[model samples]
Each structure stands twice: as C-alpha cells, then as structure tokens.
Target: MPRFAANLSMLYTELDFLDRFAAAARDGFQAVEFLFPYAFAPEELAARLHENQLQQVLFNAPPGDWDAGERGLACLPGREVEFRAGIHQALAFAQALTCSRIHVMAGVVPSNQRPEDCHSTYLENLRYAAAAAAWQGVQIMIEPINERDMPGYFLNRQAQAHALLDEIGSPHVMVQMDLYHLQVSEGDLASKIRRYLAGGRIGHIQVAGVPERHEPDVGELNYRYLFQLLDQLGYPAWIGCEYRPARGQRPHATSEGLGWLQAWL
Candidate 1:
C-alpha cells in the first residue's frame, strides 16, 4: 500500500495549525507535511507530533518574504546569504521534527537577470544545501511548479529539474515530484512515473486534483491507477496530500473529502 501524509498547510484548514496534527491522526494519517514551519517553535511542533504519533516527513525551506510575492531564494543571484541561512533554519526544524526531506523552492527570475544566471545560482545554492543537509542525514528536494500557477518561476519542468539534479549529482539531494503540477505541465503521467521513480531520484511524491487543486478523486487524473503504480514500483516514501479540501470552508471539509483516501486505506 502507498503511505499517505496529510498536508497540514492545505488540509484541515478548519482547525488551528497546531491542532491539525490530531485531526490528521484521527483521520488515520501516519505522517504529515506542510509548506513551512518557521512561524512556530520547533519544540511546540514536536510536542504535537509526539502526542499525535505522527511523523513529520517533509516541509519546505523558507521562501523569501512570502507576502511580498517572492516564491523562493535558491535561484536568485546576490541572495546566496539569505538562501543559505534559510537552508540551515530548515535543517534545524527537520532535526526537531525528525523530518528527513526539505523542499527548496527556486525563486522567480527577475526581468533584469538572465535565466542562465539564475540557473547557475540555483545549482550553486543547492550544492551548498546538499552538503549541509547530508551531514544531518537529511535530503534536500527541488520541485517544478506550473508556469500557469507561478509565472516567471525559474523551475517549471520535470526534465529541467532532473537535468539540474544530474549536474548537482548529490545523493543527499532529490526531486519533490508533485503530480498535480506534473499533470498540469506534462500530461504523460504514467510514463513519467515509470521513468523517474525507477531512477530512485524521486525522494517524495505529492498529489492534488489537476487544474482544480482539490481532493485526488475530484481531479481529471486517475489517482487510483497512479497509486497502484506507486505501489508496484515499491515507492517507499510518504505521498503528501497537498490539496485543498473540496468542501471549501465548511467545518470538517478535509474529513468530508477524504472518501477518496478511504478506498486506498
């Protein structure tokens, strides 16, 4: 069976952030993931995880100034200091939460900078992050977001990410393959899974309804087939449920939309 982790950032929005731990656990989730953990102290977050018996499988390194429209720092030139600092901060949280993987967002390319420049910066920063994370037995992940959702984002294709991974060449670094974005950008889902998952470079997997970003069952993509494929491939990592509850603002919205997950369970 495929292991699923409730994404606290998107799921269980009806409750407080800390309280979502219990909610996920009650829903039969054995693990949890989120976008960032900088807002809360590590000790408090760890307490919730311990109480809920949920393992923290993944989270992102800080994306620069989220409210100001910055998506990430890794690919932005002259921001190397800030990007490196964010990696360390993420590692600290990972150690506290006992999380093994951290997603490092590649920022948008400014009009003034060349894409090649940004790409160089991204590769350099990831090399630094990989070295830092490897010492702690943590894996660093890079994800490709869809251009429609995030225009000007430096990374937007699986091939681009894999090519960069080849250059970086660190076992401590891997790709965070979010199927929602993959389906949106590149539609050959099953083929891509067989191609990438077999390479052992996919450190984590994520899912949401394509085009809508809702529950897996609500999407155009057939998650049942995809889940079965993951099982057949023996994907050992947790698949992060990174989608908004389809119920939309109703209490227990996440739980209500979990009928899709129950079948897999």
Candidate 2:
C-alpha cells in the first residue's frame, strides 16, 4: 500500500503551529510534512515529534520574507551567506526531528538579473547545500512551482528542475515532484512521474486536486489510478496531501476527499 502523509501546513489550520503534531496524530496520520517549521525552537519541535511519535517526511529551509512574495533566495546572487545560514538552521531542525528530506525553495529571480546568471548561481548554491545535507544523511529536494501560481519564481518546470538535478549530479540533490504543479505546467502526469522515477531523479512527492487545489476528489485527477500506478512502480516514499479543504473546514474532514483513496488502498 502507498504511504500517505498529511501536510501539516494544509491540514491543521485550527491549531497553532506548535499544536499541529498532536492534531495530526489524533487524526490518524502516520507521517507528516510542513513547509516551514523554523518558527519554533529545534528542541521544542523535536520534543513534540517524540511525544506524538510522528515521522517528519519533509520540511523546508526558511524563505526570506514569505509575505513579500519572496518564496526563497537560495539562487539569488550576493545571498550565499544568508542561504548557507538558512541551511544550517534547517539542519538543526532536521537533526532533532529525524527528517530525511528538506525542500530547498529556489527564490524568485530579481527583475534585472539575467537568466543565465541566476541559473549558475542556483546550481552553485544547491551543490553547497546538498553537500552539507549529505554530511547529516539528509537529501535536499528542489521544488518547481507552477508559473501560473508563482509568476516569476525560479525553477517553474519539471524539465528545468530535472536539468538542474542533472547538472548538479549529486545523489543528495533531487526534485520534489508536486503533481498539482506538474498537472498545470505539463500534462501527462503519469508519464512525467515515470520518467523521473526511471532516471532516479524524484526525491519526494506532493499532490492536490487539479482545478480547485482542494482535496483529491474535488478536482479532475484520478488519484485512484495514480496511486495504483505508483504501487506498481514500487514507490515506497510517502505521498503528501498538500491540498486545501474544499468546504473551508478542518482537514480532519479530509477523509471525505480521500474516500476513494481509502478504498483503493
């Protein structure tokens, strides 16, 4: 059976950030991932994970000024120092929580920056971050945001993301294939997943309903078939539920959206 992980970022809006662990555990999630958990101290977050017996599948390095549309800056020039600092901070949390994967958000490109320059900078920064992560037995995954959702973000296509991973040529650096973005940017989601899987390039996965970005059943993607395909492919990693609730209710009601998944599994 495919392992399902709840994205705490999208699942538990009713609880404060610190309380999400208990909420996810009570709701029967065996594993969880969060976009950013740096707001809390590493020791405190570690304690919560132990208390709840939750497995941390993934989390991200802090992106600068998340509110200002600066999702991340790991690739921006003149920001290497800040990027390295962010990696160290993330490592602290990963170590405490026994996290195996960290998604490195490639920041938006500066208006005047050349594409070639930004790409080169991004490669260098990712190489350094990957090396650092390898020391701690963790892999850093790069996520490609869809252009429609993130207008000017760097790394917006799966092909581009794959190219970056190819250039880096580090086992520690791979791609976090979010099916929602792939569906928008590139159709034929299964083929793309197969290609990445064949090349051993995919490091993690996240998914949501297609058009609505809500629970799986609210949109057009056939997750029952998708999960079956993944099972056939022998995908042992956790597939995260990174979607919003359709009725604006708590994610515990996600069972409604995942009804098909329950039966499929």
Candidate 3:
C-alpha cells in the first residue's frame, strides 16, 4: 500500500509549526511534509516528530522571500551564496528529523533573462546541491511551478523538469512531479507519470485538484484514477496532499476528498 503524507503547510494553517506533526498524526496521517521549516528550531522540531512517531518525507530549502514574490532563485546568477545558506539551514533540520528528501525551488526568471542562461545556472546549482545532499543520504528534488500561479517562474512543465534533471546527471537530483501544477501547465497527468516512472526520473509526488487548486474531488482531476495508476506502477513513496481547503476549515475537510483512496489501500 502507498503511504499518504499530508503537507501541513497548506492543510492546517490553523496550527502552529510544531503542532502540525501532532495534528497530522491525530488525523491519521503516518507521515508529513512541508514547504519550508526555517523558522522553527531543529532540535525542537525533532522532539515533536519523535513524540508523534511521524516520518518527515519532504521539506523545502528556504526561498529568499516567499511573501515578497521572490519565490526562489536556485538558478539566478550571483545568488549561489544565498542558495548554499538555504541548503545548510535545511540540512540541519533534515539531519535532526532524519528526512531523506528536500525540494529545491526554482525561482522565477526576470522578463529580460534568457532561458539558456537560466538553464545553465540551474544545472550548476543542482549539481552542487545534489552533492551536498548525497552526503546525508538525502535526495534533492526540483519542482516546476505552473505559470498561472507564478507568472514568470522557470520550469513550468514536466518535460522541462526532466530535461533539467537529465542535464544535472545525478541520481541524487530528481524531479518533483506535482500533479496540480502539471494539470494547469500540461494535461495528461497519468501519461506524464508513466513516462517519468518508466525513466526513473521522479523523486517525489504532490497532488491537488486542478482549476480550483483545492481538495481532489472539488476540482477537475480524477485523483481516484490517478492513485490507481500510481499503484499500477508500484510506486512506494508518499503521495503528498499539497492543497488548500476551500475555506480556513480543518484539514479533515480535505481528508473527505480522499475517501476513494481508502478503497485502493
């Protein structure tokens, strides 16, 4: 059976950073993931995880300014120093929590910046980050955010993500196949999964309903069928629930959308 992990970042905004682990546990989630964990102390976060007996599947290296629209800049020139610092901060937390995967955010490119230039920088940064993560048995995943949500973000498609990963040429570096973003940027979610699964290029998976970007059933994507396809492929990782609820209600609201998942498990 595939283990399901809740992304506390989007699910339960009502809870504090440390409380998310316990909330997920109480909600019947065996594992959890988040976008960033820089504000919390590593030792403190580790204690919470230990007390709850939850596994930390994924977390992101901090992007420069999430609120200011900086998003991420892993491929931007002259930002390598800042990028390495973010990696170190995440590594500290990962070591304490025994996490095995970290998502590297690819920031948006300026209107004038050339794709070739950004692509080159991305490959270089990924190579460096991958080597650092390899020492701790951690895999670094690069996600392609959809253009609708992120106006000028680089890497908005699976094919582009795969190509970047191939150029990086490191087993430690792989693509984060986010279905929601893929649905917006490119359709045929199941076919894309098949392609990446066949090539062994996918490192992590995240899902949300398309159009509304809410819980699975509230939107266009057929998550029940998607989960079935994942099962057919024999995927053994967590399917991260990375979506916002229709309102500020409890994370359980989204859990209801997952009722079909129980059938497969």
On residues 149-239, what C-alpha lDDT tens digit does candidate 2 reach at each position?
A: 9888898888998888889978999889999999988889899878888887787889899988988776789887888888899887889
TM-score of each: 0.99, 0.95, 0.94
Where does the lowest 10-residue lDDT sum fall in candidate 2?
251-260
lDDT of 3 by residue, 130-168 (tens): 999999999998988899998988878888888777789
Residue pairs clashing in model 2 are: 72-107
Error of 1 at 37 (Å): 0.6
Error of 3 at 231 (Å): 0.5
Q: Give lDDT tens digits, candidate 1, residues 154-213.
A: 999999999999999899989999999999998899999999998889999999998799
Q: How displaced is residue 196 in candidate 3, in Å? A: 1.0
After superposing candidate 1 on the true structure, give the runs of residues whose Cα lies further than 4 Å from its correct spot. none
| Lowest lDDT block of 10, candidate 3 | 256-265
Candidate 1 residue 66 Cα shift, in angstroms, is 0.6
The TM-score ranking, best first, is 1, 2, 3
